[model samples]
Target chain A: MTEPAVTGTGTGTRAAPKLVLDNVVKDFSTRRRKTVRAIDGIDIEVGDGEIVCLVGASGCGKSTLLNIVAGLEQPTSGRVTIDGETIVGPGPDRGMVFQSYSLYPWRTVSENVAFGLECIGMPRKDRAERVQELLGIIGLARFADNHPKELSGGMRQRVAIARALAPEPDILLLDEPFGALDAQTRRAMQEFLLLVWQRTRATILFVTHDIEEAILLATRIYVLSSHPGRIVEEITVPFGANRGPSVLRDPRFLDLRDEIQELLTTQVER
Target chain B: MTDTSLQPVPGSGPRTRSGTGASNLGDDPAAPWRRTAKSGSRGRKQGVLFRLRDEIPLRHRILLAVIGVASIFVFWLLAATLWSSGNVLVPTPLAAWKAFIDYWQSGELSTDLWASLVRVAEGYALSMAVGIVLGVAIGSFRSVEAFWESPIGFLRYIPATALTPLFLLWLGIDETPKIALIIAGTVFYNILMIADVTRAVPRELITASYTLGASRLRVLTRVILPHSLPGIIDVGRINLAAAWLMLVVAELLAAQNGLGYRLVQLQRFHQVDGMFAILLIFAVIGICSDLALRGLRTLVAPWARP
Candidate 1:
């Protein structure tokens, strides 16, 4: 899984990153009026064409952080800026995928993929062309007319991905997009996501509890510690977009995985 | 050298003829009438009645139900003539059937059935129109729910029949009172049921749409409405029976040309057989309406099937 040469984000290139989550903090109030800080002091920068993953255990509020970036939930403090502009609310610039798939059951696969386009009032002929193009990318062209309920869990997620990509967002915020899938499907989805990222080169911030998943997909992995979640470390992966699942067998991958595993246990003990 | 086939595309993506393995099951719902037309004379060879007998429990159940129905008729025939005075109390099944045929021949049955059906159609349509609008509005918005929910919940406890006399006074002895009574009977229940349906729509779907760049109005119209529609249709079918039940009660109060009116008039003249005929007619109408609603549910929302 090696390429002849790489030009972007190598030792040479130092271009401005696409997304900056600067000292983001989020607070939540329980039913009993107890104030709880879900996320504290999270700082992340995602380069253009990069996939960044937030890996944490339960109660670390990785999903909450992802939601804030999506603008579904606002951060209690600090600002999230993309390309030097602060984000106030959800816009077409950032696309999102959820673990639940959340593909509209009433719509067919293509119809669901066309939803974002339809929201922006894209013309019928252009929308149809884009829909066909997306269905092909997801390998669901034959099942274009099939509703979400008729599809398997993996197929549904693929449709969700296509719909998110339809608007061609600058950043994709995925909240455990493959969390609900079985191990086999999750692996396939991870590989498929890499290919999609190579093709689109959109910056992405993904959240997951699985450490191995973060290693497989992310350009850089952010290890989040639990109990008032904060980024423990940022490990820049040496792997490139040319790599696939074959990279899992590499000695470097095992070393990184073990290193992160040790840090996780040690932090949890403290 | 860089792999050329796996090339970068800044504009329109290259057509790689996706090799992604996705199963395709195209629309293939069975249509019986098409087979009949296509087969022509051959259709008789595999007649609808006999062709699927091996697959269906209906053929065997039909004979069992026929025997059960015949036995009831025989018991009625025997019991009605058991004693000289018993005939006055229990009318023979033959006499009831004969009464039906007589009323049908005299055109009285048609007029009564038509009147009741018209009233039900008008009143039921009105309830559905208002109930759906108010239900979706109230269920989706907290402010709307707060304004209307308390009164709707309170009104559901009062039986619509109890308001028949009030409706009669307000509307006089016309079809208006009859229709209004049926509307009053079913509307409140429908409002609550349809509201429950709207509330039941999953919150994840809404958030997903919002993140997909849909506006607030788009979420309501495209997401919430369509997601809750199948359940709303189911609620409507359930409430249609309530509408029919109310029609009978309302007709008993003032309707001069309905089946309920015919039943009352028949009893006044001690025509027990004709009264029994009207009851059987009501049962038949109820069964037909239920079948119709089930068919409509399938046609409108095949995706809702388990």
Candidate 2:
């Protein structure tokens, strides 16, 4: 198949990528004294302001890869760098959203969002203002004083996103954030995420198993094979920044979706 | 009667309204069959009296509690009156009431109550402070856990009552020994319980804090401490009973005018009514403190479910 012409989206260019993972590998030691390889030799570059989705099946170590980049886990051999500096541990430069909404149960929506800012010693007034602004962007201003338990699952996930975004991290790492939501809510959240992306233009590294979700939200999609996960193919989504839900019916979207489905199924068979 | 019997069963018409949107029973051919089959047995009215895992109204709940307490009181009254033949071990309700009134009128009740409350407050407050510090340390860090684990394990097994004499020998016969005994009894349990609560804090929260650029101290103070606060308060509530137990033990051994010391005096005089009166005071105090701690938990951590 011929490659589609490069659009004006920021993902097309790779020069001085914002975040780079160089030959990253992770291995876990089992109780049987055997080393189990999780992901091997992953080299990925997410350009600044790009939405890159790592698509894979369960047990494919896609989350492990994201965690390595987030500095929540260390790679066994390779290195991850952002802005040319190697990441030794978790820092405020990268924000993370987990599948489980990790909002502090004790904190209100506003307090949860302000947590990171509080950690960085932002003054109380500034923290409140920043939290209010982010809540407005996420459209949860009315829920500022409400605890997480009071919000719906979708709303809580939005608050999680807002919290991660509060410190203004350079990169946003999301690990199957909408996996727990119902189908209808998931679609709504996908749109909300795109809206967030369009407004902030923050670089995002999203990991998910759903090919359709990948195609809908990603500027570039990296297909990963399971059982010692390795990158199998890198496909640039043909849609531009103006892409919408209508793209689901677009011929090109269907073709790319089928291609990824075929790639993943063949990987499982192998 | 015949027409009504032949008509579609009363409540089963709405029961078969499935999500398939077959709202008109006449339009669907299978609806009558479903209604007839379901109406025979499944259409019986369910009683609200014994709902499965359902909440009763507050007034009903209070009424039930009153009945329960009244039944216990009736049983006690019967036992005291009917079994009054041999030794008169159980005091009559009126006798116990009179004894309580006499003790109150003498003003000795206030003195003894004040003495016991002061000792408990001092020792329990000291233990809680120490326990929380050590528990947070032990729970948060491996080195601290290793340092304190074995010593605490060994010490907790030795009964605090057993150590009463030792405490007396070491700290002398003043309030020091009594306070020391209460601490010895409750602090170890508090430490272990609070440590477990701290350790139970979700790892994801700590990791999330780190990714948000929280230092270890900040994570401890901001995340773990607040998250564990409700659980710690729970631990305090449960262990307060132990503190009361130790208070009685400490006062029984030594010195002046505590409830436990008064109980010993009453026992010597065969004043079982006074003993029962003192026991009632203990019960009241226990219930009040438990309720207070529960209120405090709700106040500090409103996010936590009751």
Candidate 3:
């Protein structure tokens, strides 16, 4: 895909292309010490305020790619850069949401959101204000004191997003944010996420196995190949404004969904 | 044929009921219980008199209580019957209770209890201080972990009682060895328990803390310690019980005055009631301390389930 051309959204200030991954590769050794590659020679760039969704099969290594970008894992070779700096380790600039609602079970929702801020030595008053704001944005204001276990799955995911956004990071890394929710809740969360992104306009790197979700939320989608994830296809989805639940019923969406599915199926069999 | 007008035929047309003295029962003032049955899951509310705990439910609490009480009663009955032969050392429950009151009035029991408690307090305090420090260090440092794992595991399984004679020889028959024995016996378990818990803290949580701009030392203090607190308290509870066991053994080896010393002296003279009185006192202390430790654990870890 060509560089994302900056278009004025009437916000006066456009976000920069904040995160870039160049020819990144990652591998792991099993118990028997045999090496298994996860991400293979994949290059991606996430512009500020852009939503970049990665679509792949089970072993396509999209999740691994996100982890590398998050700095939770080191790439076996190549490099990742954020805001013109070589990424060495995890930092506050890249906030991540795991596939599982990885909210600390022992912490209340508000505390979980404030955790990053607390680590960075934010004063109690400021942390509390930031947490309250995020909670309000996620529509979990009443659940501030509730633990993760008490929350429904979708609610937990909202809290996770709120937590990642609380740090006001330059980029957001999400590993299948709505993968665990039921179909109805998943659709609702997709719309909810879009609203969150529109409000904050933080760069997002979302990994998912669902083609429909990729089409719904992503400004651009990257299709990954199976086994040592390689970029097989990349496309720009030209979704107009006022997209929501009605987008799924659009005839064009079904046709694009089928094409992606057939492509992935053939690649998997091969 | 006799009451045809009142009864009618068996195969008559649909029978119509006269309006009862009441309206729909649900709409009545005292009909809340009727609606409760219709609400859902009626079985859940049955036999609530037995539901003593929110989590344990009625059935489990009832079963546990029955078994515990029956076991105690059965053991006391058997001991009484067997001791009637004058061969067994068991004292009758009444005789033991009488001795307990006598000692309490005379104040001898208070001294013995105090002496034992003081020794346990000193030894356990020392053990806790050293154990937690060493455990955290070894658990976090890979080199230390590798070096201590085998030796610690071996020491954990060895009985503290078996080491009493050796501690007596090394530290002598004074309060020194008695205190030393308790410390030696208890500290190893606490260290291993804390170390195991410290090592089990999730790597992601620590990394998350680091990514949020926390230093390594800060992560250790804030994230690692708080996360491992439940496990630390768990081991602390277990050590409290173990410390008491070691205290008695240490006293038996060498001590002039303690609950253990009094029990042994009374036993030699066949003063079964006196011995029984000391045993009962010991049991009370053991039980109360266990309850206190459990309460502390719950307070420290409000999020943890009992």
* Top candidate (DockQ): 2
TM-score of chain B of each: 0.74, 0.82, 0.76
- Chain B TM-score for candidate 3: 0.76
By TM-score, who's the top model here? 2
TM per prediction: 0.84, 0.89, 0.84
Point to the candidate with the largest lDDT: 2
lDDT of 3 by residue, B51-163 (tens): 46545657877998999988986898797887676567677778888988988898888888899999999999999888888898788888888898889888878887888
CA deviation > 4 Å runs, candidate 2: A1-11, B1-39, B42-60
Write the residue-wise lDDT of candidate 2 on A1-270 in tens digits.
001232244545653488999999999999999999999999999987789999999999999998899888889999899989999899877999988878899999999999899888899999999999889989999999999999999999999998888888989999999999999999999999998887887789999998999999999999999989999999999887667899999999999999999999999999
Candidate 2 - CAPRI tier?
medium
Predicted candidate 1 versus true structure: per-residue lDDT over A1-270, tens digit per residue:
113233465422433678999999999999999999999989988877678889888888999998888888899999899889988777767889989868887778989999999888899999999899878878889999999898999999999998998988888889899999999999999999888877666678899888888888888899989889999998988787678899899898899899889878877887
TM-score, chain A, per candidate?
Answer: 0.94, 0.95, 0.91
lDDT of each: 0.83, 0.89, 0.79
Q: Per lDDT, what order, best first?
A: 2, 1, 3
Compute the lDDT of residue B39 as modeled in candidate 3: 23
**What is the DockQ (computed on Cα atoms) for candidate 1?**
0.44
